[model samples]
Target: MLTIIDKYILKKYLTTFGVMLGLFAPIGIVIDVSEKINKMIENKIPVVDILIYYYHFTIYFTNLLFPIFLFLSVIWFTSKLANDTEIIAILSSGISFTRFLRPFIIGASIVSIIILLMGFFIVPKSSEGFNNFRYTYLRGDGKQAMRGESTDVFRQISNDEFIYVNSFDVASKTAYNFTYEKFTKDKLAYKISASRIQWNPKTKRYTLYDYVKRTVGGLDDKIEKLDKKEAKFNFDLEDLTPVVYIAETLSLVKLNRFIEKEKKRGSSNVNVYLVVLYKKYSIPVSAFILTIIAVSVSSMKRRGGMGLSLAIGIAVAFSFVFFDKIFGTLAEKSSFPPLLAVWFPNIIFGILAIILLRNAKE
Candidate 1:
């Protein structure tokens, strides 16, 4: 069912895309190493760890810029075809422009599937490793940074239990002015307060200083006080000290579950998580849009040659990234809808692709 032309174009498409990735990957690694080398030396980071970190970084970097890479590769190869008069000959052979696009669509489908699979399973693991490495070895205040804000933390640990802390120390795993409240049928059943609470990892327990417990009754209140108390709670320090990039570190299934949990907990950063979740699908869908745009723009022979086409392709690619970043920031920082932010760039570029294709056909 496949023609020689289709096979030829598909081979060029895949090989060019792979070559583009190969070319950019080393550049990215070199830039990253240059920035992080001093930190690595200062921390005496293991060479094995550094190598592993870059391995994950490559996946994270590639996935982040996959559309741009695909777009450029398509433009590069198609422009070559146009320059060599291959496209003109193919069009002259009575193959409709739409028919000529079949292999391109097929190539896009293959890339999209690979990107989708990576987004679902592979990229999450790589993201976790990449971020963890940066925070653990590269940042001076890594734990505090990873844990986000250090003060005024609140969380609902369960349906009936809520916890609050005025401030937390990531280095010591300590919470100051800690309060734990339990409600039964929306009425306060009991409350625990501590001047200071520290997590003892060795014991897997909490030591609360100046601890007090209050019990509510129909007619009176019972209060117990202690200089120090050691006990277990339903939640751990991780519950209070959520990493800023926690959502990015989860696989698709886990990310969905995390979003639901964050929603129940009334997390303020839920929009950031939603943006990440929406982009997993949006980025893959961009493969098709960018492929079509690339073909449309470069399939026609122009006096400007491949260099001109590449310049245009780079501009368009950067513009796409710019739009994506702007909308993503708006969604993360403001009340803009995350789903719309994720798809708006694709929608705009999809329209452009259609218009360009029509012009090329004409």
Candidate 2:
């Protein structure tokens, strides 16, 4: 059950989204090029490479701007419709305000779906290549390895070995209260405990200080407690990536896979990842919510013209984004679930939409 006027509103909003992209995407690229030209000159880089790098970076920014576009697009389009008395015409024609919402929801739903899929599955795959290429060509070498947080006591590198360290000191390359487990054939084969563990990045190995080990070979397990020890093992670091598994670095799917791996290793830094996953879904849903909110807020064209509607739209959108980031960071620090962290902004705005629409209908 669809009406022609509803489709008209949806089309108007989508058209606005496209026009905004066309206007802003190039501006983003130009601004980026202007800022980065000096860096390119300092590095003695070529024009082509610089262009490619900026283009890759543009993808990141474009993704960031998408939600903003969604808000403004809906606001601008709906405000125009109201100003022209088209909405009044529809209402007088026996169409309820709620009925007018159907097409806008459908349009926003489509766009939001595309954004979620791209964020989670598509963009991250491309980002891997773009980022690696940048690191190899644009960035400096001698990149420092990652550091671990004190909150997480256990570390996992792969399937076979799991380690527990009391405290890890980044500068000293040492860990206190170190315990190691090596599994083979789905059974624990060796267990080592150390008072201190030191890492040698050159060799990619760890040397355990004041070590004791137990080897489970036969029915009788032989335990050897060493006063001090050295061993070549891969349990040298903790966390998925200090710089590697960063939000900016991951799109969506890669982020999920990374969180899963870290959880398996008994790591506790997944709050950020979980929030990001929720955000990937929530942001797209915002397209639908914002569409309804815009229609409610702007479709009447009061003393405030399109300029006022646009300003309100921008302010509301900015507030949502700011609160979303702050809450997500807080969730990362606290025990807030990632899904809640990600969707909190959308939930607040959706409620706002319901209230606004109820008022508008009156």
Candidate 3:
């Protein structure tokens, strides 16, 4: 049994959300196009391709900024309602403030479901195109495809296996100063060192330059040397070194498997992937929390009307973004846990929402 007030408020909430997207998305596309237009022209990129890129850009930017839009939209319409005395009339009609919040929660739930679906299924595919266009035409080709924290990578591939590479060249499919070592039961079993290693896509094998292999026995070590050799190792090219956007291009299932595999490999950059994983889950939950905060704050009719409410909304929105970035950076650079970093913003604001909601209720 949907009351008139519930229907009215729900319509307003969802309408404002859609209108916010309509208002900001084109502005974003325009600014993005302006910035990239010169590069597109210089690179002789086709108009159709550029337009397609903006289509993906629209999706990417809209998803990236959806929470901000949602927060602002809730504040806008609710403040308008407060100004018009609609909330006062409704409350005077014997409706509890908690009951009044039902439609907003319902609206938030709807938006959260949409966003969760987009983040998991659509964003990954669109991000691939958006990033490919940036790297290929916006940035120059021949640069290292992957941008790990360090060019010189060292990792434990297993309990007794370790690998090292000084640098990798994505253009040439080659690694410099490559080494792999294997140990068994606390004894060195074998070690392989090479001046360079190149991947052959067709043959699916590695060509090692100036390769040296040392096989250790109980009391003695046997060494073998070769100028060049084709070898098959336990890892693939993506396993040894993946591009920065690799995680962004994977679906939820693949991303989890990737993180687990990286954890097993003792990769130093696993935190980065974990951050992405946590954010997908966090964003949806934040939607509901932010809706509560927005509705509670804006439902009051302040002396300055919609202007004051919007000012407060903007401040809170920026604070959310700031907290998100600060903690995300801390997680990546320091020992801060990725899960904590992703959820900390939601936790802090959720507490704030509770306090505000209590005050609003009283």
Candidate 4:
């Protein structure tokens, strides 16, 4: 149960967090606005629209960094108490350090929950609209979004098939320098080469131009020339496009569906998508872990006041970001489990929080 003092501290912590995020976010965007000023002007983004742009930016900007601030907020609030001799006074009143933590935990827990919601559910959805708005309106003439529908560097329609192309133009929905391979019975059965492959949207089939087909069996070889008007190949946008964060843009259900489709097709390099899926859920729980870390580090009164706490909070937060990237790189390039890569940083920090909480109380 939280006593009156506990409630007071909790309120203070939350208040500080809100104020800091509230102020810092706009300042950050203002900085962004300045950086993009030339492009914004060139794109003719109106002043009013600029405000709307900032509004959208804040949703993602704040969400992107809320966990960091929440952790720092804990440190700031706790350290303020310590630096003010309030912590000593509370301890002197026979309130054990452990007992005093109840309120901080409670406060941090609430913050964590809020942050988690923003990270998984709210932020991803908002980011798409925000990014689209910027690229369409604020990015100006030098930039053009990937408008073409055709894609390359993907698993082909046939099982054990693969294709790689330098670029695909959306205007014609065609790919160039296309090579398609087919493997059967664990043997390379055939190879197809086309200078260009196009999508006839009206027909819902692909057409390859100036193509050659070759087949090899044991010592037998055959070659055929293609002068056909169109060649039919079934591939969806999701199948051929270089899997970027497109999977991430989808909701949990949609993301899972994509994962299943890609798996059934025997596409490797689905690790990035899997990472995004797990992170959607895992990131929310981190709100809890980060809160614990913050309260443990910051909720004490020290001579340096909130500044010291803030620094420590930032250090821990950055460590999480750094390790997550490092592990992600390892997962993509090396043979590490994608799930483990995304979650390892969180796990490490969570353990540290537990240890810190124990040490803080003692």
Candidate 5:
């Protein structure tokens, strides 16, 4: 059902994209290794682990910069076609420009689907490993990467229940100075305090040390004490000591459930997670928008040839990344809506795509 021209253009689009990615990915890996090699040596990290870390980082970096590579590749190859007068020949062959764009749209659709799958499935796993290694070994400051992984935790578990811990060790799944309180109608109902609390993976329960409980009555409170107690609580250790990269490691379904749970917990850090969620969808859709814009901008031949097109494409790509970072930072630091921040660059670039396409058509 497809014509020869359609097949040819489609092949060119995908082939150029593939070549661009293949060429640049190694450069990225080399630079990353060069930067981290000293740290790996200092830490005496194994050669196999270093190689594995770079493997995860390669996927992470490629997916992170997919839109830029996609835009530049489209512009690069299309500009070449224009300089060779191939576009003019195709147009003169009784083919409308709109029909000529069919292959491009098809190519964008294919790439977008792959990007979407990478975001939802592959990237999360790669990011977890990549970030974990980078934070643990390559960087001396693990707290910045993992956030509250080894800090005190305090949260309102429910309207009537509150919990606190003086300090927690994620590696050991243990907490010190643990406290839980229940209240009714602005009055304390019961309170429990313990010197230590530890998660027992084998039993799937918490063991508390030097446990104490207080039950309040009208004018008196009954106090109970124990050396140790095994119990279960309504929250998980992950909920207590949240890592900054926690959201980056979840699939779409798990991400949605985590977001809903965080909302119920009244967490102030929900916007950070929301930004992650919205960007996963936004980044893939922007690939289609950027492809349209890239094709439009480079389809016409200029005296400057491919250089001019590549310069313009790279400039536009950098601006897209800049705007995304600014808005994303605003969402994380200020009261800006995460959904709006994530999609604003896409909305603006999509409009640019339309205007450029119209001008190219004219």
Candidate 6:
């Protein structure tokens, strides 16, 4: 069912895209290494760890800049075709412009599939490794940053139970001025207070210092006190204090579950997680939109030649990234809708692609 021209253009499309990634990935690695080498040396990082970090870094880099690389590749190859009059020759052979675009759409579909799979599965794992390595060795106070806010932590662990801690220490897995309360039908049921609480990972239990429990009843209150007590809670340590980048480290399924759990907990940063979730889909859809835009922009010979096309392509790509970041930040900081913020760039550029394609066809 495939024509000779379709195969030829598809091969060119895929090969050029691959070559673009091949060329830029090493440059990205080199730049990253140059920036982080001193920190690695200071930390006395192992060679194996550094190698592993770069492996993850490659995936992270490719996924982050996929659109730019894809756009440039399409423009580069299509401009070459235009300069050589190859596209003009093909079109003169009684092929309609819309028919000529079949291969490009197919290529875009292929790239979109790859992007979707990577965003859903591969990039999450690589992001975890890349971000963990950076925070563990590259940044000052990274541990505290990863642990998120350590003071005045409060969370609803369940519909009826809530917990609070004045301060937490990441290194010791300890909380100070810990309080736990339970409510039944909006009425006070019981309360537990501890001067300090330390998690014993080996035992999967908590050791509470100066532990006290008070029970509420009809016209009566009973209180119990203890010097120290070992207990188990329904929540994990991560549930108590999650990392700032925890959402980025989870795969699609886990991220969905995490969002649901956070929604139940009434987390204020739910918008941030929603933005991440929506972006995983929006970015892949941009592959199609950007590919179309690139082809439309560069499919004709110009007085300025490939340079003009490339300049336009780069400007458009940067504008797309700029719009994505602006909306993402707005959603994260304000109450903007995450779904709208993620898709707005794609929607704007999609319309631009349509206009450009129509002009190119004419």
TM-scores for the candidates: 0.82, 0.71, 0.79, 0.72, 0.84, 0.82
Tens digit of per-residue lDDT, candidate 2, span 103-178: 8888888888888887877655545445543444444422311223432366667788877765444435676677
lDDT tens readout by residue for model 3, 1-362: 77888999999999999999999999998888788777677777778778878887888898888779999999999999999999999999999999999999999999999999998999987876676567555664323323212356677778888888876654366777899999899878999999889999999999999999999977888999999999998876655554466677678998898889888777788888888888889999989999999999999899998999999999998899889989987997888999999999999999999999999999
lDDT of 2 at 31: 86
> Which sections of candidate 3 miss by over 4 Å?
140-233, 240-243
Of candidates 4 and 2, the better by TM-score: 4
Clashing pairs in 3: none
Per-residue C-alpha lDDT of model 5 across residues 172-271, encoded as one tens digit per residue: 5677789999999988999999988999999999999999999999989899999999999987766655446768878899889988988998888899
Cα lDDT for residue 42, candidate 3: 75
For model 1, the local distance difference test gives 0.88
Evaluated with TM-score, which candidate comes out highest?
Answer: 5
Task: Give lDDT: candidate 6, residue 249.
Answer: 73
Q: Which stretches of candidate 4 lie over 4 Å from their true place?
A: 45-53, 133-242
Error of 1 at 266 (Å): 2.6
Window of ten residues with lowest summed lDDT in model 6: 141-150
Structure candidate 1, residue pairs in collision: none
Worst 10 residues of 5 by lDDT: 141-150
Lowest summed lDDT across 10 adjacent residues in model 2 is found at 142-151
The true-structure Cα RMSD of candidate 2 reads: 8.3
Ranking by TM-score: 5, 6, 1, 3, 4, 2
TM-score of 5: 0.84
